[model samples]
Target: MTKELKESDPGSPSPNVLRIILALRKWGWGSFWSQLVLAIIASIILIATIPFVTRAAAPNPNVPIATAPSPGIGMGILFTVIGIGIVYFTAFWSFRYTKLAQKLRGANGGERPSKLQTVKLLKTGAIFSLIGMPVTLIGANAIVGALTIKSLTPQPTGGYVGVISVQPIDMFVVQASILTILAHFVSLFASLWLLNRVSDKPTN
Candidate 1:
């Protein structure tokens, strides 16, 4: 005969939230690492391609013109890679927290996790997400700035040209930065919601 399973207390938290958190934690970190690696590779490829593309698209001129050293393309690539890492890290941590909560609840017989456990998980996820925000913004800015320089400015006529300007693409990058920040906030909120739900007693 199969042994009967013991029922959990009615006052305990819902198992669903715990399940969600557990799933997130299991897969989130791995996904983040993969994304980061891919982003870095893509940035490197883009940076390498920029010069080739520019050379191929260069207008042929019978008349010669002076040229100046361009801003470092490598720096732009680094920035993009860093930004992608930050964004991916934030997303990963948020999901990881949710997953951990779920796992704890499920492992503990569908009961609420201890206050300390919840606090620890929340603290870790929030800290990383907060740290990632500035890194992402700066990285995005660098990429936009680099692309803008390439698109708007013509080959230099004399000594160094100080500020290369591109209005439209810069605007798009700024908007994208705002969207990224919003995404972080949304992820944080979702993590917190899962934590709260898992900690609260079940309704029925």
Candidate 2:
């Protein structure tokens, strides 16, 4: 049917286009559920981190509690970085999958993408996730830290009392974190589906 569609109408959408649509139709719900699971897990880890860090910072009861620094600038930068990474990775896989689909359109009957090609694509994705997930998470953590500062009010109680105030700019970090997390999981599942499609044996 896909081949017939391509042959019947020169202007019709390419076989690759149809493949993409089918892949989306098949994997869309799986993608959503997987992303939801990841988001829930990430939230749990984020929640757990707060108390651990708090306790670590004040291990001894005798010492006075130290003030944390304003997270505005640092978190804003980190968020921007992760946001860029998520976008880059998503865009990267989208382009790769589209190109692979187009390439497969010309294969002979029963042909499948070489194992090496599939492995390479998976490796590239894994490398990106390894680097990007950590960086994004660290940025999220910075936001958590920023949100949990002891006090923002000026206190003359110390040699170096840092400001703990939240600024309007910090909202960007929060927004970016939310978007990045969603994008990260959605892209992850979509990429997985694309990989499966590209690796599948061709059928008429």
Name the candidate that leads on lDDT.
2
Worst 10 residues of 2 by lDDT: 64-73
lDDT of each: 0.51, 0.51
Worst 10 residues of 1 by lDDT: 1-10
lDDT of 2 by residue, 2-106 (tens): 444354645444455456545543454444444445444444443443443444344465533342324333553445455444546454554555445444443
Provide the lDDT at 156 for model 2. Answer: 47
lDDT of 1 by residue, 47-111 (tens): 55445435534544643322211344345444544655566666666555545645554555565
Candidate 1 to truth, TM:
0.48
TM-scores for all candidates: the values are 0.48, 0.52
Q: List the residue pairs that clash in candidate 1.
A: 18-102, 21-98, 21-99, 22-99, 25-99
**Model 2, position 34: C-alpha lDDT score:** 48
Candidate 2 residues lying further than 4 Å off, grouped into runs, are 1-76, 79-83, 107-115, 150-165, 196-204
